[model samples]
Structure formats: C-alpha cells, structure tokens
Target: MEKVKESEAIEIDIPLETSLKKKLQQTPRWETFEPFALSRVPYIIRENNKELYEPKVVSIGPYHRGKESLRAMEEHKPRCLIDFLGRNPEIQIEVYVEEVKKLEARARRCYCETINLNTNEFVEMLLLDGCFILDLFFKVRAREPHTLLDVGWGAKTIIADLLLLENQIPFFVVEKLHAIVTHYEGDRDSLLYLLQPSSVSPDLPAKGNIYHLLHLYYQWFVPGRTSKQRSRRYSGILISTEHSRSNPIVSWLNSRSSRSNKKPYKPMRAIPCATELREAGVIFKRKESPSDVFDITFENGVMEIPMLPIDSIRRIIYMNFAAFERSNSAMEHDLMSYVALMDSLINSNRDVIILQQCGIINNMLLNEEELAVFFNQLGDWSTLDSDKHYFAWLFAEVELYCDSRWHKYRAKLMRDYFNNPWSALSVIAAVILLIFAAVQAVYSMYPYVHH
Candidate 1:
C-alpha cells in the first residue's frame, strides 16, 4: 500500500561447503524432535559466499546488554515508528506493530521492534548512529504466529528457526488482526506480516498463500538471488504475482500446520569427540541441542564426561582474529581465562557449581554471590540439554576464574597485612625515636629543656 522511501534491499546467497552441508544434514534417527534441519534440505548444499546483503552485524556482549540495548533502540528509531503507528492505527499493519507500541510505552518492556524493515532509506541513519529495537513481541495478546521470515545478517537463521518453533512470527498489525504488505524490498532482519484475526471468519476468501510466501522468500529473503546459476538455482519458479492477483488472499478455512508436510532434520545425537587443545580436555558431543556445546550429564559422582582444564585451551578459546590482530593482550587473557573456567565446569561432577572470584573447588561450599553469578550467566541452565548446559557453564567458569583470581590477589594483600603485625610496631618505634631525637637536638641548641 505505502512504502518507506528510506529502505534499500540487498540479496545474499550463502554457498554451503560439502562439510557444512553434511553438518546440516538430517540424520533420520531424531527427525521428530528437530524438524527445521529437514525443511532446510532444499538448500542443504548451497554455493559458497552466496551473495548476502542486509544491515551490518550487530554485537552485544553478554556484559553490555542494557547499555547496548538502549543504544540500539536510540539508533534504530523505534520510538518514531511507534509514535507513527500509534497515531495512524487505521494504517493497517502487521501483528508486530501493536506489540511495538505497547512496549514503547512501558518502563520495563521486554519485546521491541529490532529493525525498521519498511524504512530502508532511514536504515542507514539508524545503523550509523548505533541504535536497535527491543524485541517487544511479548506484550501482544495473540497466539504466537507460526510462520516467520528472517532478513538479518550473521547466523540470524538460528534465531528465526527458534522463533517459528516458539510459534511467534514477526509481523506488523494493520488493524486488530489484519496484516498489510506495502512494497517488496529485500529482507535484512526487517519483516512485515499479513495478520489473521481469530475473531474473523475462518472461511473468508482472503487468507494468505503458502506459495506466495515461498516466492517472497526467494525474492526478498535470500541475500543474493540474482547471481544463482539457472540449472543449479531455485529462482523464478513460482507463478508471477500478476497471475495470483485474481485472488490475492487464499482461504485459511482449513489451516494446515506450517510444518505439516515437511519433516524435521536431525543430526547425530550426542556424538562425543575427544578434544585435547590444552590442559583443556573436552569430550564434545557435537549433535546435541543447537545451543549446547557438549552433550554430557553430571549426577552424584557419575559424570558423563571427565573434567577439562582451564589453562590447557587458553590459546584457541581466547583467540579472536579481530581482537588478536589488534593486539589486545589484556582482553585476550581475560577471554581465555573466562573460557577455560567454563570448559572445566561443563564436565565437572558438581550439580550446582557457584562461579566466584574464588575458583569453586567445592560445589558444597558456594555462597550466594557465587551462585548468583553462575545462575545469572547461565540464565536457564536447567532447561538446557547437557551440551548447552556445559557450554554455558564453561563460559561462566572463565568469568568466575578471573573474578576468583582477583579476589585471591586482594585477599593475599590482606593476609600479608595481618600476618606481620611486628612490622607495624617497628614503624611506630621508628616514629617515636625520631620525635625524641628532634626534642633532644632542640634542647641542646636552645638550653630551655635543660633548665
């Protein structure tokens, strides 16, 4: 209907390597649990450097969540869009729009508009200023939308797949449940959705089309769609929009599962491999949960894997090409120490390891601060599979190690002060002797003290 003049689209095509393809392959064994891997079967072995274009990659270190989040909002201009949508409620948007408005008004809103998809021209303004939108989808009162379209940079597909499974699609709200599509530009973490109001008749003629959605992805979602080879490519296979205009909306009278026909893809589950990079020894289980780095359990004295060492794998864990080239040894050391500690705990037998400035030797002796640090860093550890749990634990461990080392260093200074009390007495005696000597010298010179 209406287009934001500021937006420009870029297409990216990521060619999957042979190894990456195999890595993405679905092992028929656990297909029921992880289905997205199967649906991605179509593009399993894509070409390398598949052309991709979108907003630049955004970085939010675990330490700087609040400040980075606020900065992202200010840079992304969510407030302007929220205000715009609020005033023009009749403008016809996707379900996501309503969520944004509610959150923008909240003091502590969780959900937010992460990027402005419609406003391409203004995208640069937002990006250059270093702002972002908070994900405010939680405020909306709707069944999470099943289908999702992701148009962001760098491994965003992971987040997108997770969202879809969570039953939350990113869409703007034109009306209470009506989603409108203005213009088609390339996808870049920006999105628009056609809404389906529950109160509306299910038998209505204007439901959305699965094929049209597919075409939209081929057209706008993929980064570099144009460069694909004819025989090797999946371009221009669908009927043109002109052909489908006779009935722009398909009926959802009998709604099907978004993943109805497609099966889930599974990689090998809990395939442990021994890694000996340093004193850091890991029995990494490759195919566990997507979020997990290892897949071993720990209960009582029965650990699924042996504990790893922190000092052993410091080099690889701390080596970030960018940071390394820049010669940030301090940061490198911190990161290395942090990762090592995490690696150790992931394989440890302790069920509740408290990460503190004092390296946790005994899980039984953890204090509140140590527990809080561990829990806070590994926010939902209990819910994770062993792989994720261990990975999180390892990361948290490194941070704790650094803290513990600092604490120990400070403690040593205190211990030294208390250990040698005689040193303080010696200093006092010297001061008293100096005062007496000064008085005697004054008396001898002036003869007032002798009288």
Candidate 2:
C-alpha cells in the first residue's frame, strides 16, 4: 500500500497473515450475538432494581472480577488454584492452562460483551475463577469448612455471590476441572451430587449446559412430576407476546396467543387473601410433598398451597432467577409470575397475618409488612403479562372458591349464629319462646272456631 507522507509518498508492505487475521475477526457493529452462557442484566430492568442486579461481596467472572473492593476475595483465588492443583499433582499447571486455552474462543463467545482480553488473559481468568469455585464446592462437599468461608457473613455471602448472574464462569470449565481432579466414575458422580446439594442430582442441567449458577438453580426447582397446567380454571388474562421472530429483541411472553387455530381461553380471576377466603369457609392446608413451591390447589372447600419462605436469601435467589429468566427471550418468567400472584394476595399487613396463621407463608423474615412489601416490589424488577402467567388458572380457581354463594352464606352463619356459646344460646332461646307463643295462638284460634 502507498500512503502520502507530509514530505513525500511512502510505500509499505502489509503481511498476508496479519491482514487475513484482522479481516476474519472483523464483525459488523450492528450484528448482535445470541447468548450462549451469560449476559448482563438489561439496563431496562437493572436500572430500576440495581441492588438486586449487582453483587455485594464477591466477584467471579471478568466483568466484576477485579475491583478494588472485591480484591479481598480475589486473594483466595490463587490459594484455591494451588489447593486444586495439589489434589491432582500428576496434572501439571501447564496442562490446565492448555485445556482452558482450547476453550477460550468458545468461552469468549458465551458472554454478551466483546471481551478485549487476549487468549492468555481470558484463560488465566477462567483457570483462577474455575479453581475458586471447584475448591469451594470440594470443601463444602467434604464438610471441611475453610477458615475464611466460616467467618462472619462468609458462607452466606458466598452463596449469594455465586448465584449472581454477572459472577458466573462456564459450567463446562468447572466440569472439566472437576474431571481432572477426580479420575474415577463413582467418585466423579459424588462431586456432581455435592455441587447441587439442594437439588436432585439426576436432574442437573447435559454435561446439561446452563448459563450460570442462577440458571442452574432455576432449573433445579422444576418439578419432577409430569403434571402440566394443573388448574382447570384460568383467569386474570390469557396472553402471549405477539412479536415477529425476525426481530432480535423478541418479547419474552409466549407466542401461543398468535395462533388463530388455538382454542379461546377460559375466564379467570385473581384470588383473595387467606383470611378473606377463610371467612368464606375455605380451609387452608399446607401441601405435602408438592413438587413446586408455587403448586396450589382449591378443591371442594379446601385451598391447599405449598409454603413459601420469605427472607433476604430467598428474595435474592428469586430476584436473580427472575432476572436470568427475563434475560433469555426464550424462557418464561415463572418466578416473576409466582411472586406476582403472592403479591396480589397481600395488600397489607392483615393479609400477611392471615397467610401466616394459615401456614401459607413461612414468614421467616418475621415481619409481615416487609414480606408483603418485598413481594409487591418484586413486580418492578420485571414485568410479565398477568394473563400469560403460569398461575393464572390457580388464581381463577381460588376466585371461584371464594365466590361460592353457599360458602359465603355458611361463613355468615358461622360468624353471626355460631360465633360463640352466648350467641348460640340467645338464638336457641328466641326460637323456643317464639315456638311456644305460636302454639298458644294456635290453641286460642282453634277454640274460637269450634265455638
């Protein structure tokens, strides 16, 4: 190529290899990539709920991995790497680096960002982050709590930190590291079980590819039972996102509503609080061995619902789960829908009090008002059309159960007539006296007619 200099024309030769490499790597700025592993919470959602979106204590991936505040935890990464390598002394340090180097391209493609990191930097990050996670899991599984992990806000903070969307490494990298550590089949299966102590091991998402720990956690709770659409009644509204697939930013709502051939939806309504329904003679019972936390049923006069725990940890988990689901255009916002349903039922402290009495809400936070507010505010994190929500049918059923004329009348009877012994006795005496008076009148009328 020839270029004109300030004084004269200059001729320079470009290398074919370098030129080809530059051309091959060049991508259109407008072209967006589909998320293969992880993504940042969309600004639309994160802006409103910043605390819910950001990690507080520990950072995992390259995004938040190297902050001044997070440096305290960063020191543990090398120590973990050393410990992990010590376990498998036969495998050299260079081997792990090479293995991760092979995965560096695929991993770079996983994140939504265009990583500025070269191959060496990215591989180093993966190795360090992956080792920290592996060591943490190994220590937890072995019941050998590391001194740092057991100190103030240690384990609890790490659990929350690991579940952060931005703080995730590729599951494949973790699996590869795990395999390198444990060579035998029986031993390897145990580690997998240890990784998800809270969930059924058999169901962990293929070699299952997950976006991150939060995604994996969301999948962990999916019911093993094959029961689909448990409620016969669906209310509030039936809908799905009506968007053309060609658009990259497709709405997360279901597209079933667009199919003209599909059957029309039945009417459904939101349910009342536990106390209001109880007044209507509806009994609330805790579900036994239910597959899903949101699994609820209204049959005859009984409303059986699984208990939901309300606390800081649960709220954090749920918020991340909803964010993760919302980030992926293909997945449904099941967590958001469930939280919305609960939030709708709780208007104030009274509603929370009622649910607590019925064993409907664990109320672990021990503050009814706070729990209700937490659930209510969760809707702001992400929005899902109520009609297309997963629990629409359950809401309709509860509304139907509460609206029963017979139940309302029975509730009134219980409240007014059989409220207490004194009320019952007063009614009984009034009826007896009225009967006697009627008999006396009848006798008098009979004598007059006979005369």
Candidate 3:
C-alpha cells in the first residue's frame, strides 16, 4: 500500500487499470465523487507476496456428482484461491474468493449454501459501473440471449440480475422458471405473456429471459430504480472470537456483571438485544438452535455472530480462515501476520460500523442494531493518524451517501407534486382568466374613445 498522509485525505487510485477507470468514468455520476471517503478505503491492487494465497479453478464436479477427479482438484482449489485473494489489497476480492470457496464446499455436501450475493461485493461492483455493463449486455442481447430471473436474493439470481441491468436484454424472475414457460408461454392476454413467448419469428434468436429484460427495464425504463430490489431477509453472518464471544462495540452491553440484577446467562431467560452503548446503540438476537449463538445486526448492516469470539472476528476478516485452520489454528500465513498489523487498527477504533456490504447481514433472524461494534482491540496502534483518518473518512462517506439519497427522493416527490395535472391546470386557468379580463377592458375603452 502507498503511504498515505494522515493529516490530509488522499485520492487513492482505483486498483483497476487506467483503461477500466476511464471506461467507468464515462458512465453517469449520481453525485459528487466522494474523494475523502473513497480515499480511506483501500483500493484494489494485486500483490506479489508469495505468502499470499492464489485462487485456482477447483473442480466443481463433486458439486456435479460422480466426480473423483473433481474431488482431487477441489482439495487444492480453495487453498490456492484464498492465497491469491489474500495477496490483493482490495477487500472485495478477499471477501469474494472466501465466499466462492465456501459455497463450492457446501455444494459438495449435498446441501445448497444459503448465502445470498445481493448484499455482497459483486453487487457493490454493479452499483459502481452498472451502465457500462448494461451497454455490453445490450449488444449481446441483439444477437442471442437467455435471461435468468431469480425469485429470491440468491447468488445466481444476483449474478443474473447483474447481467441484465448492464445489458438491455429481456428476462424475468417469476416464482419458478419452469412455470413461466409452461403456463405463460403463449398467452398475450397474460400481462406476463407479452414478456414471454415472442411473437417475433422463431427464426430470430428469442429475445433473452426475464432477468435481462428486467435489468434493461430498470436501467432504461425506470431510471434511478433499484437494480436489485432488496430482499426483506437479512443476508449476512455474525462473526466473533472463539474463546469469548464478546464484540468490541458491545463491551458495555455484555459485561460479566448483570444488567437488571439478573444472574449472568439465566436459564430460560433471554438477554436484551437493544441497548445504549458508549456512543451508539447495540442490538442483538438470540439464536434458537444454538444456546450460545446470538446474532448482532449492526446499524451499519454488518452482522456480528456471538458464536465465535471477538478474536476470531479479528482474525477471519483480515486473515483467511482457511489459512488459519490449516495451520492447526496457528497464525502461520502472512495474512495472519497482516491481521497482527491490523491489531492496532482494531484496538484504536472505539466504534466500528461495518456497512451492509460487509456481509454482516447474512444472519437473517435479527433486528437492526445487533452489529454496532465488531471486534475491538485486536492490535495496539492508536498512534497512527492514518488509521484514524481511514475510519473517519469511511463514516463520513456513508453518512453523506445516505443524506444525498434522501435529498434525491425528496426532490422527486416535489417534482411529482408540481407536475400533477390538477395543480398545473389550476395555475393555467387563473392566468387565462386574467388575460381575458384585461383584453375585454381594453376593447371596451377603445370603442368608447372611437364613439
């Protein structure tokens, strides 16, 4: 990482190539580029560190069944991918590789991984440069396209939505993919039918699926509409240390001492999930299945799980979990060493608010405040001004972003009110009446003067 000055904010260059940056720059800007906030978050940059893991194409065959060769490939795929992503400076890449491996592994177990990608880094990338991607999809759609509509906020659904929004393709995500073709294929009377079976010649490649169509509709038709309609379900996981599940932001809430003369961990009694913390409120929920498990959904959207202790959260976020697990729970890889470097960052930070994109929302069963503070005091460096600036920029950026969105919605409402026919018609009628009365008086006066 380039040394950044602590006193002044710096515009960190995108880890992406200059060409990619230029391409994205041409897209429309919704608001002023938040330079200060953007500067604080480390941009994506590839690393040459041999200590970092490299991603490999794991044989997804076990996911496909009857795949022995795939099992061997899978054995090495995750470790390689983690190492590759760890070396990169971009946090998104690190998060992505970790998730992909996890999903693939879960697939091997004959059960689907329940994680949703809508709230993940990939979705964040789409928000950043959706238009550019949409344009590319339009070109592809003109030739041939197959749309994929996802009913829920699943990973594949998100990926499908990303493709559609970036391109002007026709696609839909009904409750079920098969039902759309079987039930609504040819019925024009069906509002859904006009979208389905194309009256266009069978000769022409069928205009793509609902997924692509929806993306184009959102991008071109419903401008400013959400590309991915957020699902109501929470889509993140809570992480904590292994030994003690105490989160740094909740130091005051989860003290060993009792809150209401209630003995600690009273049987059959649930703890208060929401409470006032040092400078903010901490919210949490108890896990029904696991007595020790508690879900903390942060106000910023980062969810903290009490199942793991705070130290674990500190290690997992910075260091790849696979590396740590492989080392017999020892911090052997450079990623863990980097986690050590982040200890100062983790410690100095009094309040940590992880934005929803950080995968804190993966735990679905909680209200908003469980995740206010993540792990605290992993490292010792409160001295470096850069870290302070980094967090300051982050919080400020999020606040400004939210405020701008509110202002935009407010303006839209005002415009709609003024544009209503009844309001416009009343003003026009009043003006017309005044003009007519003035004309009549002028004509009457002219006639009298002539007589």
The Cα local distance difference test for each model comes to 0.27, 0.70, 0.29
The model with the greater TM-score, 2 or 3, is 2
How does candidate 1 fare on TM-score?
0.20
Clash count of each predicted structure: 55, 5, 50
Give the number of the best model, judged by lDDT. Answer: 2
**lDDT tens string, model 1, 232-341?**
10122232222222221121101221345533322111222111111122222213222112222322212243232222111111121112212222221222222333
Off by more than 4 A, model 1: 1-184, 187-414, 418-451
lDDT order of candidates, top first: 2, 3, 1
Better of 2 and 3 by lDDT: 2
Judge candidate 3 against the unseen true structure and give its global Cα lDDT, from 0 to 1.
Answer: 0.29
Candidate 3 positional error at 340, Å: 12
RMSD of each: 28.0, 7.7, 28.2
For candidate 3, give the lDDT of residue 334.
Answer: 24
Model 3: per-residue lDDT, tens digit, 369-414? 3323222221212122221221222222223233345544644544
Q: Measure candidate 2: CA RMSD.
A: 7.7
Indicate the TM-score of model 2. 0.78
> Per-residue lDDT tens digits of candidate 2, residues 1-451?
2345622432235567877888777852333443464888777867877777677777888888668878887787888889889888998999889878888877777787777887888899999988888888888888885966888778877888888777888777776777777764334455557577553446443244465666666777644223343324233333222211222111211232245353433434356766677788877777864346756666677878787766777677777776677777676667776777777778788878877887878887758878877877666657665555666545545655675698899888888998899999998999999999999999989978999
